[model samples]
Target: IQLRAMIRWGLETVHRSLAPWCSVDSIARHLVEQTESLLLQLSDVRPLAPNKSALNHLLATAGWLTPPLVDGLQALGWLIDERGLAGTAATDGLAWCLPMHELFERWVEHLVRLWAYPFGGHVRSGRTFETLVPIRWSSAAPKSLKSLVPDVVVELGSQTWVFDAKYKNHFEELDDQAWFELAEEIQSEHRHDMHQALAYAATCPASQIITVLVYPMRLPVWERLTARGRSVTVAEVLGGDRSVQVALAGVPIQLSHPEQTNQIVAAWNPLFSVGQ
Candidate 1:
């Protein structure tokens, strides 16, 4: 009932506000028309305002039965997060948007963990609250600062590396446009990413600290960059008394062959640890 209502609400909102704009876009028109048709097939399913309590009850009741059910419940939960089409204006006045970074973050963690398995040190993830380092706040500070959490931390002996997965087009942008020629917003955002990565590095108390910003890119691009020794760009970030290397790396997605994956891991051996 709630699912049907959510769908109905979405269709209604789009039809009322977006119909004029969607008419000229072939793909958008098809999706809108398709949703209308599917809603017709689900006529027996009554429309109801999405209820959080009921949805939780349903998920807990059947989520344990099957994997598909769990996925469906998760998708439904994302749809009903406080970011509903029914915000402050009306019951049907917004669009559903989902961020893709969390999935990318998880994939980064998996890849790094898998490749660095031979190093023999524990892996910690920011998602699991395993890499949190509390911050000491001074009195009279309008304190929003709390702690520094790195996306992935690998500690091999006295050497530590913090890898922060950024789902950015920096690889592509840098390829197409010169650094200074890029848009102001892009440069600003990149600076922020760098700042966050530096903060993450502070969480480690190792003699040698390497902080890396890992971005996903096409396998072909990764290969091209590797040929030029630009796949992993590393430079000394801090001088004198402190040793810190800041690196921006391009990591390709998981490939088909085990040997191919191993090849990639071998290339990353220097950054993480010696190969097994």
Candidate 2:
């Protein structure tokens, strides 16, 4: 119902904008036509007040809102309680936006896909799934298998690296003491992320499995831990590229930077020779 109203509002706003433009571009015409078609399909759905206004304002913005609208719908769906009201709708607007973790995961996946080209590899999106531990069995077990899928898997030759982007602030302060004195809940969450990454690594048949936990922080930091001969890492994607020597387990990966194209290519120069 809410989705239909949002789309209807969008269609109306676009129609209004396109009406004044005497020479409409191909893109604007297409958008207007598509929205009209969609509005017809959603004629039966009714709109809710207050929420509709908020959604309309969001959709009236300049940039594309398809992805954000989808995200908001998902948020609204999950947040509705037994009483049919979003638990946090009155308190915050999160119910009308994408979950932070999902947003981060998608952003990381996008960056990894772009970066994979330099490594002569392709980033496969959720192509691999690992069966859950203590696998549940039923008479129709063949039809059902509990599985876990990593966010992105980068394959280069025989090497398979699983990248899981976790949008968590796992550290309290930038000090060894802070890490050692982490709160119990935070420690538990970190341990869970590590276990999940290890699980993904174990599912890979490749001899060299690199499991990296990509986290967002204000500073660029890197940590490597090895358990049972497997490499587990926590990599912080920083705000800006402060240095050019960004290497992960001796394999260089570029971070966010404005003037990084030539430098990134130069950094990959060594890897190119090794690949040959």
Candidate 3:
């Protein structure tokens, strides 16, 4: 009954405390209206704690729909002076702010899974791909080799598509002339990203491997290049189905709106056609 509890909380909190024009009250009102009489049935239910830490943990672990409700509650808590309800007086005790980078990565993983599922591709996240190499000098000691865990890996037949979701906005990074001046120094991490994506392709256990460095960008773009005799490509995708070559590529994923998620899966369908 967490769902009912959430609806009840949002409904009651808005009614009790938030004015019509409060930052969150409008959203809360719309949510209550959408849920209709359902909240009335849960009159006896109590809402979750409005504490920032507790809500952040819940948002991280709860189902997709729950996070927004929890977020609304957080906003309500702050606007209506429920800081006392959080039971914390320290300034640092405020609600946690989830990192944008991690959220973007998760969103990309979701899109990858959605696109891969219908193509008979098994999509996995945080899959470790590793290889073994002998130590430089032999001794009575343990040996270790580094491993690669791409954000999303799609396995179809003997072909594997390795993907790393980078949260950095290449458009923003490259557009500013300041970044170009220190391009090598400021964008060293980008070079590392390219290296890592290619490394995954080279080391993966597949007859044919396609590596992609996926990032979020606001505009349409695509590029193909060869670095040290290896193929590297980049493309942007949004609300339309477009073909992306199934080789080394940097594909920009677009989620301009929540409703566009289905478009994302469709946009990348052409990737499966490649190497066929």
Backbone clashes under 3 angstroms, per model: 0, 0, 1
lDDT of 3 by residue, 171-249 (tens): 3455445555755755788777766766566556676566777666552442111112112333432232322223333
lDDT of the candidates, in the order given? 0.70, 0.51, 0.56
What would the per-residue lDDT of candidate 1 be over residues 1-276, giving only the tens digit for each residue? Answer: 556675565455445443543533344566678767866876776655456676678777863547765554444454555333322234332345546788778767866776668767578899998998899888888788788888999888777889898999887687778999999999999999888887877667887888888888888888777777777777778565657888888877645443465556556766863221
TM-score of every candidate: 0.60, 0.44, 0.52
Q: Give the lDDT of residue 59 in candidate 1.
A: 74
Residue 64 error for model 3, in Å?
33
Model 2: which residue pairs collide? none
Candidate 1 local lDDT, residue 170 = 89
Residue 181, candidate 3: alpha-carbon lDDT: 73
Q: For model 2, where is the 10-residue window of minimal lDDT?
A: 243-252
Candidate 2 lDDT by residue in tens digits, 9-35: 544544655544323234455666775
Inter-residue clash pairs, candidate 1:
none
Candidate 3's error at 50, in angstroms?
A: 17
Over the full model, what C-alpha lDDT does candidate 2 score relative to the true structure? Answer: 0.51
